[model samples]
Every structure is written in C-alpha cells, then in structure tokens.
Target chain A: MAKGLDIGTMNIICSEREEEDVVFTQQRNAFLELDSSDLTETMLDSAKVLYIERDERIYVLGEDAFKFATIFGKDARRPMRYGIISPKEKDAIPMIKLIVERVLGEPGYRNEVLCISSPGEPIDLDMNPLYHKKMMEALARRMAYETHVIDEGLGVIYSELSDYNFTGLGISMGAGLTNVTLAYLATPVMSFSIGRGGDWIDEQVSITTGLPKEHVCATKEKGFKLGLEVEYGSADGALSIYYDALMTYVIKNLNRKLAEVTPPKVEFPVALAGGSTLPDGFLKMFERKLREAELQIDISKIRLAKEPLYSVARGCLIAARTHEGEEIGSGGETEEGAG
Target chain B: MDNTSSPGILQRGALIYYVGSVTFAAGIALLAVGTAFITISRIHYGSEPEKIILSVISTGVGTTLILTGINMMMKQTRYGYYIVGASAFISLLALLIFTSNYPHNWFYPLISYVLTLYIAGFLALLGNAFANVILWMIEGKPEAVVGREREIKIYTDEEIERDIEEATRKSIELSASELKFKEPGVEEVKLGKTFRETRGNITKVKDDIGEAKSLRKTINPGERMKSGSVEVESVSRNLGEILRKGAVQKGRFGKIKEEIKDEMKKFYSSIRVTRNR
Candidate 1:
C-alpha cells in the first residue's frame, strides 16, 4: 500500500488506502522540553508520557506534550514554524522523525511509495524550502519508502479537482502559510505561497489585542465569523480584522503573480483547503475579497474541500497511487522523482 | 512610349489610347464607305434623298460610337465596354434597315454588319485586357531587398568530426563539474524514541504508585501507632543528633520548596497572561 504524508505546521497527517477505505492518522507536531532528572523521569514514566531523550534532556512530544504544558501552565513549543522545520528548535528533526514514524508506522513493504506534501516557495518570505523537503524525504527514505515530493497546493487540486479534470486554482490556507496553485489538466502552471495564514492571523490578533496567542487561537477555532462588521474590542473582533487583512493580502498577491504569467483561457474553479479555511463563513469572506480584488481570470466557482484539514494528505495519497500504477506499468524502471 | 523602354513597363494608359485610336480609324473608314455607297446610289440610280439621309444618320451613329470609345480610353474609364456594346447594337439596327430597303441584295449589308460586330467585339476585349494590364501595372511587382548576408563557413568533413569531438569533450567536462557541485546526503540524523515503550514504562510506574497510595490508605491506625513507638525506642540512643539533623533537613527542604514554588509561579504567570488580557 502506498502512503501520503502532509507535514503541516499544526499537525502531521498520514493517509493510506485500505481496500476501498481511505484511512488517515494524525499527530500534533509539537513538543515540550524538560530538564532531565531522576524525579522528572519517574514522574513522566508514571504518567505514561510519550517522550524522547537527546543531549541528556527528555522531550515530551505530540499531543501529550500539549496536555503536559497545559497542566504545568506553560505553552507547548512547535518543532516546525511557518510551515517548515524550525531552525531555532534544536530537537526539530528528531521530533519530526518521531511524529512521522508514529503516524506512518512501518512501511507495509520495502520501497513502498510515499508522496509527501511540500509548500511552494513563499513570495513574501526569504526562506528556502529545500532543507525541509530534503529532510522529510531523507526520513521517509530511511524508513524504506520510496518518496516523492508534491506541492501542498497541488495536493489540494489532486484531492478536489478530479471532477474538473484537475483544471482549477487550489488554495490551501494552512496554519503557517497559504499555498496557491493554478493547475490545468493535472499540470501546475503556477504555484506559490504567502507567509501569512492562520498562525499569522493569530499572532497579529494577539499583538493588537494584548491577548495570549493561545487565547486568540482558541477563539478563532471556536467559530468566529468573518466578512461581517463586529465591535473592535473583543478577541474575536481582532481575529476577524486580521482574517480580512490576510485574505486581502493573499488575493492581491495572487493577482500580481497571475498577471506575470499567461494561463490558458479557461474558467478556473477555486478550491480552498487546509485548517485555516475550516471556519464558518471563510469561503464567503474569501469570495468577497476575491471580487474586491478583481483578479484577471475567469473563476467558475469558489469551493471548500469537504475535509479541509485532510485534503492535502488525501491528495498526496492519490498521487502516490498514481505513481505506484506508473511504476508497475513500466516494470519499476522509471521512478517519479521530485520536481 | 520610348523604343529603349521595356514593353513590360509601358503604362496601361498609353496602350489603351493606342487601341482606341486604331478602333476609331477603322470606324471612320466604315462610315466613309457607307456614306459613299449611299451618295453613289442616289446620283447614278436616282435613289431617294431620304435613303441618303438614312445612310448619313448611320454614319453619324458610327461616328458617335468611335468618339465614345476614344473618350473612355482617354479618361481610363471603367465603363469602356458599354461603348463597344452600343456600337454592335447600332450596326445591327443599320443592317436591318438597309436590308429592308434593298431586299434583292442583302449580302452587302449583311457582310458589313458582320464586320462591324467583329470590330465591336474586338474593341470590347481589347478594352478589358487594357484595364487588367493597367491594374497589374499599378500594383507593382514586389521588390526583393538583399540585406547583409551572414558569412557561413562551410566545414570540411574532417573539421566537422573534430568539432563534434570537441563538443563531446566539453560535455564530459561539464558533467564532471556538475558532479563536483552535487550535495552530500545527510548522514547523522537520529530518530526520536518510540511512544509505546515509554507508555508501557509509565503505566507500570503509575500502577506501582497507585498500589503504594492504596496500601498507605488501608494501613490501620493502631498498627501504625505501635510501629511508631517501637521505631522511637530503637532511635532513642541517637535521638538528639537525629533531631538536629532532622531540623537542618526540614529547613533545607523548605528553601527548595520555596524555590520550586517561585519557578512554577513564573511559568504559570508566563503562560497565563491571557487571563490579565
């Protein structure tokens, strides 16, 4: 069986097909560090915490880390920041490996195909995605899976645009980044990402309102409506303000980038996916922003993925399945490598 | 037209005028012959003066056709074919009238009408051909402009082989350089610890802790008091030293607890800022 992995900032999800069923397994991609000591070890051991030891330090990982942090009245730290491996986190690689391993488990067979989703180069940030992509590929390869890298936005297209013959615009509003891809007939013509997304909105709202980032995050996730006027004092109001700004910024950049390339003259249905797009009224707000921006392309419709958070993983699974078929048909000689 | 000029370059206007002049001269000759025949018949056979006038009218109509053709050719008019058609019609009408007058000898008028028709048709065709030629001349031939030619060096077979060999050599060198630029794979990456083993260990520790707590809760107070008295009797010999040591240990424990409480307070305060907000 082939696998699809989405190494998202907030969560890491792996998808595999079991007969006619598509199974998804997820783990929070966060951790908390504790100074190593006999008492601490004993306490953690007694509590049955999932952790790793590096440099004589014990690090609690995944959802358990968040639970421990909440109990201890501290914040859980992320191994990935802004949709890539955190350069500031000393244990980022090991932590990611642990999370990925748990989610993917042992490969069903040697050289099992695993297509991993990678974000496009951000237009607003001076960050190179090569290191993160290579690290993930290396980790998956170490586990004996022949890996392929696919753009996160294109993954959404693969999952959602099958009805359109993969001709559409796919936008994945993830936690740390928003990826946009314009694909025609299953081929991507243009793909890019912006550095602003759910996390950026949370951070901005937190700063503007003097609230904790977690509180803003919780409020946003708890169904704060956008594209409506709201009083300006509350956390939800601040979140709504930033959400509007983020959407406008995304639309403006999409327009500018689209102007640079000539795409085929066909109506493109825009599909929105990922965690940030899951809130109520997000698609409506996005549509409003899109109309206000007056983009220079025909948009047939604006759609939301049925399961926004799982779309990338599901699309990656579809891609892996396609690659597996090609390999089998070609007698395993031609391997689809990363672009 | 100048004799030195190529016939291909002759202006269509001049050619039309030349054809028109020839047709006019032929029409005048025909008119003069018809007029003379009418005058001779009137003088020798005492033909009617009205017949002579009719012949004169025919001559006048022929003169009008010739003049119309000349005007069309001179003006380079597109309506030149109408002149030729009118000429043919007038000639046929004149022949019909002449035959009705001389029913016994129709051959002469018939031949003249036939000749007139032939001349009219020829003029029409010539006018059409002239118009086409004028159009073609006005739409001049495309001129071929020769810009500076690139110097193409023709290589001998030996030279071609040498160049190919040189290109192959350069490609090999390029590949070698590319290999040098290739990045090395990561070698020291370490995987983190598994969740299941840690969970198992924690479960065992939890069970042990639970058992210890339950056992402590279930112990009887009377048995505990008896054990405490026995323990006190056993430690009575070094009770003063033990008491001093216990006092020092309690003070140290207090300091450590205070520090831990302060640290916990800091951690809680850092994460609980949302409450203040």
Candidate 2:
C-alpha cells in the first residue's frame, strides 16, 4: 500500500471572545520550512517514531516507516481522502501502515505494533472496547499480520498544543466529527471530539438535495457559500436545506456548550483547525450564527491554526514529545539505552 | 565571349600573380645576399676596407633572407589541385632562373648542388599536385578553389568593367550549381539553385518541344505527307539559296562569329566560396 490516507470531520468553533481562525504563519507572510521530523531522528542511535493524527484515526510508525509511504506521502498534495477509504478513521491505519511499508522500500522491514486514537473524553464513562477493537483489528489487518499489538490512549498533553505561545482553544473540526482541545503550557488540557463535523454538514446537504454523500461533500468546499443570501428555492434549494441544518446544529452545539458550562470555562481566545473549514467567509458565517444564537464571543480572539490540514499531526508531535522535547517512546526512561 | 564576361581565370591568375610578386621580391634579396659573399671573400684582412665590405655583405644577406622568408610563408598556401599545380610550376621556373644568374664563383655550386636539390624538391611538389588532383577527381574536396575562378572572372569587366561584376556573379552561380548537381546526394546548391531555375524561355521551349514530340507521336504518320516511297535520287542542295537568307536566318557559322572570334561566350562566370575546412 502506498501512502494510504485517512478521512475525518472538520468543524469551525465560534465563541464570544474569539472569531474562529486557523493561523498558519505570522503577520509576516514568510513561512518557515516544514521539518522532516516525521521521517528523521536527531541522533543516529535514537530510534525514530512517527505519529500521524487524522480526524478518524491515529497512525504510529517506527524506523523508516514514514519513508515506506514516501511515494503516497507526496507533500505536493497530501491525500485528505483520495482513495479506497471513505472519510473515516479506518483510513488512518491503512494510511500509516502503507506509509511504513513505503518508507522502508526493501521487503521485510515491517513491524506491526498497532495503535489508534480515541475521542478526547470518550463522552461515555465506559470504554467502548468493541468499537475501538474493531478499528484496531482493521488496523492490524491493514498491516498485513505482524506480531506485536497495542492500543494508545487519547492524548491531552502539554508542550504540543501551541508552538506559537498561544493559550487558546484548539479545535479539530473534521468531516463527521468535532473535537475541541485547549492549549496552555504549550499542550492541550481537555480535548473532546465527536461525530458532528463537516461530514455531518455534507450529510444534511445530501439528505436535502437527494444527491449522493460525495456530491454534498464537494459542494461544501465550493458550492456551500455560493448558495447563501440567494433565494433558497433555486436549484440549490435542497443544498440550502443542508446548509441551514448544519448552521442550526453548529449554533445549538455552541450555545449548549458555552451557555451551560461555567467554571471550566474556555480561555479567552480560540483557534480553529481542520480541513473542512477552508471555504471563503467560513469564519463570518460561524460568527453570524454564533451571534444569532446569543452565544457570540470575542470575534477578535479567533485564530486559524497553520496547515489546519496538519494540526493533529503537529499536536501529536507535541503530545509525543518528552519534557525535554525529545520524544519518549512507550518504554519508560529505563529503556532509553535500548532504543 | 566567356573571356569577356567573367574574369574567372583572370582572378585566379591575379591570386597567383600576387604570390609570385612577393616571392620574386624575396628571391631578389636572397640573390643579393649570395652576391655579398663574393665581396666579402675579396676583402683584405685587418683593413678598414675589409670592415666596410663585411658590413655590406651582412646587409645584403640580411635583406634577402628577410624578404624571401616572408614571401614563402605568405602564399605557399594550398589553393586547389589545378591552381597549386600551376603555381608550383611557376615557382620552380622562377627558382631556376634566379639561381642561374650569379657569377661562376657562386653559380657553379648553385647550379650543380643547389639546383639538383631544387629539382628533387620540385619533383616532390609535383607529386603533391598530382595526388591532390586525383583526390579531387575521385572524392572532391569542396575546399578546392579552382572552380571558384569562374565566379571571380565574372566580377571583372570586359565590356564595361562594372557590368563585368554581374557576369562574374552569374558564373559563380553556374559553376556552383554544376558542382552541386554532380555531387549526388546533395540537397543545396547555394547560389546555383536560383540560377538553374531562372533559365527563362530556354527551358520553357525545351519543355514545349518535349510535349510536342510526344503529342505528334500519338498520331500515325501514314495520314500525313506520305508520297508513297518514290525516288531514291540524290539532288544537289543549293548553297546559293541558303546564302540568300535574312540576317536572323544565318547558319551556325554566322552564330559562331557573332561574338569575339574563337572565344567561347557566356553571360557570367562561376565562383564558389566555402567556409575554411
């Protein structure tokens, strides 16, 4: 499998003090070079492990695993969901498993200790072992049946949240789910993601349009904004229905969360992340909806994370790092010499 | 007529002429140097007259050598098989004449020893000329300048010297085209392609004649002027009747004499230039 892909939901978070955003670079347009961290290690003796966090799944790899998927991992354009996998978490395992195989290039350089990411707080007190098990079983299968196996817990770590010294809410608004994580101490404290993201919006659009889900998905990227302010009864009438449905749902969710919650209140500013939030005027739409719901926050406080496309991976990097920023493996400090 | 039009042969002559002139000047100096030795040999030892004579001798030798060396280096160039051959012949002749003229004191040695050496050198040069000619005949080198003379010839005037240039230009076109066609597998004939194509009415008439012959052959001859195989008697043809013809109706002899007698006429000469190979 060459650079397999994962698909997930994307959402935009609008709050009272923050206008939703995704800050990629700074006031200066200059962008720093993207690090080849996923594929490299600082020291030769240190074993390299790459962690990829996608909307639906998390990919973990070691050694030249990232390079194994080099062909499919063409940065020229990262495949959001361009292949066999639907816009879902199942995509990530195959994506990373293929990535590992691709990087190694030679045969027999593969190892199969599998893991996948779960939602922030699991919403339910009980762990749904069945659902996670199914996802991991599928992940292991994608790895073509190797030995070792494991499950990684959903991470809420420090030092990985805000590389820019930002202390705001970081949201992974994906296609079928929404996750919000706050950063202070350079890492996210509480993060929660559920099935209420871009895919849901597209689904509503599709239900109204009687079109396929894929069509609705494409329309969100391009046709979503073009349908606004125009009469709803045009040929885009059904799509408008999906649009209204998403807007209403997003508003309700924001209102319920913000109005109901008190002490564990979010930080003043909030940053939006994820691929689904890439349309024009998306922030304004969220803001207007938030204001109408009487749940508006500081519009100026919002910022968009850089490469909303790679927030999870970046956050995963931060989460995967040790106190010294040198990433610690699953083995404790005692095994530091082993790697 | 060709002689009048293009001074092609003349230009080639001019090139050789220039070279010969320079060589001639140098040979004169060399001869003078040789003569100085004579003066030096007659001088008295330790006398002031000996010093003066020695200086004179030195001047003579120095002047001759400098001039001769310069001339040889300038135009001992490789022209073409034909032209080089001609120049080589001329040089040998000049060498003989120049070497023959000194007093017996110097002349005997120059004639016997030096002249023998010259003959051998001349034979070697002739061998070079023969080989070059053979090479051109078999596998021609486009660098050969012999053919280019026709072009140079046309550039000179016979009638009005200015008009002569057009003739020279035309000649180059002709010669260049001729070579190009004869050189099978060639695609371009440089200036010659245009000239071959612009033959005007001459080619048109030829084409017409061909078409007419083919058309006439399609008809059986029996239907025309067949006075059925009558007499085999030979009759005296009337030369007087032919002589009574108009000015334009003259026979071939008249046409031959129409231009300068005995000279083959042409509107132009041929010359070709190629990048130095």
Per-residue alpha-carbon lDDT of candidate 1 for residues A1-339, written as tens digits (9 for 90 to 100): 688899999889888776446677877898888777778777877776777665677788877887788777788889998799999887688678878887888899999999999989788998967678777887888798998988999999888877777789999999999999999877888888999889999889888999888778878877777748788698877877888888889999999889866799999999999999977989998887787777888898889997898889888887886666532233233222211
Residue pairs in steric clash, candidate 1? A45-B202
TM-score of model number 2, chain B:
0.23
Q: What are the per-residue Cα lDDT tens digits for candidate 2 across A1-339?
A: 011111222211110001122111101000111233323322211333233333322233332222333433421112122111233443343443333233212212253222222344323233322333344335434444231211111111111223234344555565545555544434333444444566566666666657666455555666456336656544255555554566567556554544423323444455565656566555666556655665533323555554454444333322222111111111221111100
Candidate 1 global TM-score: 0.55
lDDT of 1 at A171: 95
Q: What's the CA error at residue B6 for candidate 2, in Å?
A: 99
lDDT of each: 0.70, 0.36
DockQ for each of the predicted structures, in order? 0.03, 0.00
Question: TM-score, each model?
Answer: 0.55, 0.32
How many residue pairs in model 1 have overlapping backbones? 1
List residue ranges in candidate 2 displaced over 4 A: A1-117, A121-166, A183-190, A222-227, A231-241, A258-267, A291-300, A322-324, A327-339, B1-277
Given candidate 2, what's the lDDT at residue A14? 10
lDDT of 1 at A173: 93
Instruction: Categorize the docking of model 1.
Output: incorrect
The sequence of per-residue lDDT tens digits that candidate 2 reaches over residues B1-277 is 1232222111234464356456556656656765666575554444454444444434433343343333332222334334444545544554444435533344565556645644454454545545544554454344342433434333224336534644674465445432211112533211211222221111000111111111122222222221112211111122223334434465565643544221211211111111111
What overall lDDT, based on C-alpha atoms, would model 2 receive against the true structure? Answer: 0.36
Tens-place lDDT digits, model 1, residues B1-277:
2221233332233555666677777667767876787767653345665665467556755565565455434433244345545655655555555645553454776757755754564455455546645644564432201111236589778668856855784476445432212224644432243465421110000111111111212221121111224434444434445456656788676665655555444433322101010
